[model samples]
Target: MSDHGGSGEPTPRILVFSTNNISDPGIDLAGSRHLHYPATVSVLAMPCSSGIKPSWILHALQAGQDGVFIASDGEECAYLPDCAERTAHLVTVTQGLMAEQGLEPQRLKMAAVCSVCAEPFAKYMREFAAALSTLGPRPVTAG
Candidate 1:
C-alpha cells in the first residue's frame, strides 16, 4: 500500500473526469480548503461526456485511485438527449459493476453541471471527498 504523503499516513485519491471545455475551477480552491487530507486529486478532461468509457473508470481504480468523479454539461450536450441519456445510463451501470467487484459504490459518481453550476459542483466535490475520507483508502490490487 502507498502512503498518503510519504508521512506513512494513508490518504484517499480522487480523480475528476470533466467534459471538454467544462473547466472545474473549484478543484484547486477546494483542495486548498481541505488541506488536512493533503488533497491528492487529479483532473482529466474529456472532449465530451460521451468520450468517457467504462474501461477508463475501471483503469483508474486498478491504478489505485480511491474515488472517481465525472462531471458534464448535461443540458448542453452536443448530442442533446441521446448523449445525456447515454452518460447517465453508463454511470448507473458503472456504479453497479464497481460494487459487484468489491470496490466502494461511492467510488464511482456522476454529476451534471454546466458552467453556471460551479458552486453546486464544488459543493458536490467537497461532500464527495468528505464521504470518501470516512470510507478510508481502498486497497490496491493486481488483477
Candidate 2:
C-alpha cells in the first residue's frame, strides 16, 4: 500500500545472487535481448547457489537492499547433486531467523534457472519485484 521501496525510494532495489554456471548466463541473455525488467535490479555471481551463507543475505538487507533473490542453478548445477535442495533449505532457515527478528520473510525469494532460460529469468524477476513491492520494505536490523 505504501511506497514499494523500504526506504521510500521510488523504485525497489533487488540483489540477485546468480550462480555462474547457469543462472548468470541466463541473466546475461536477458540483458542482451533487451528484455525489460526493473532497472533497480543488481546481480552478484556466485560459484554455486548452494554456497551462499545466511549472513550474506542478512548483510544485504542491512545494507539497504529491498530484497534478496537467489537465482539458483536448478538441476543443471555442476556443484552439487541436489543444487536446488541445498539453497532451498538455506532459504528456509534464513526465513525463520528473519521472522524471529521481525523482518518480513517474503523479502527473500529463490528460483531455478538454467543457462538458456533468459525469457523465464526475466519473467521471474518481474514477478519477484512485484512481490517485493507488495511486501514493502525490510527492517534494517537482524535478530
Candidate 3:
C-alpha cells in the first residue's frame, strides 16, 4: 500500500522494503499522524532481508525514487541467525555504488527492528523522511 502526504508538489518517494513482520498498528499510527515532510512511501514486504535482491534497489533508484529504506528483524530473525547482517552488507554495497554514480548514499538506509519495537520503527521512519526532505528529489538519469 502507498502512504502519501504533503503539499501539491511532488513529494520525495521512499520505498520501504520490509523483511519481517511489520507492525500494522505502527504503520497505521505513523501514517495517520503524518510525517514532517511530504512523502510518498510504499511498503513492500519480503520473506526475509536476504530475499531482497540488489536489482530491486537499483530499479527503484533508476526509476527516480528519492530514497530507499530497508527494515529487517535484526538478530531475532526466526529463519536464521543474523539474517539482517546480509541485508546490511547489501545496503552498504548498494550505497557505495549509488555514490559512485553521483547520488547521495545517505538516501539509502538499513534499519533493524524487532516486531515489538514499533516505537523505534516509527521513529526511524520519521527520521528517514526528514532526511529525505533535506536531500530533495534525486536527479533523473538515463536508464
Q: Rate the local accuracy (lDDT) of all candidates.
A: 0.71, 0.85, 0.70
TM-scores for every candidate against the unseen true structure: 0.76, 0.89, 0.78
Every model's Cα RMSD, please? Answer: 3.8, 3.5, 3.7
Q: What overall lDDT, based on C-alpha atoms, would model 3 receive against the true structure?
A: 0.70
lDDT of 1 by residue, 1-143 (tens): 24555566655677888765554533444444543333576788777777788888988888878888888767676655576778888888887877777887888888876755655666776677668778876755646
Worst window of 10 by summed lDDT in candidate 1: 29-38
Q: Per-residue alpha-carbon lDDT of model 3 for 1-143, expressed as tens digits?
A: 12355444445678888754543334444556653323466777777777777778878888767788887767767776868778788888887778777788888888776655556767777678778778776765645
Model 1 lDDT vs. the true structure? 0.71
Which regions in candidate 3 have their CA more than 4 angstroms from the true location?
A: 1-4, 7-10, 20-39
In terms of TM-score, which candidate is strongest?
2
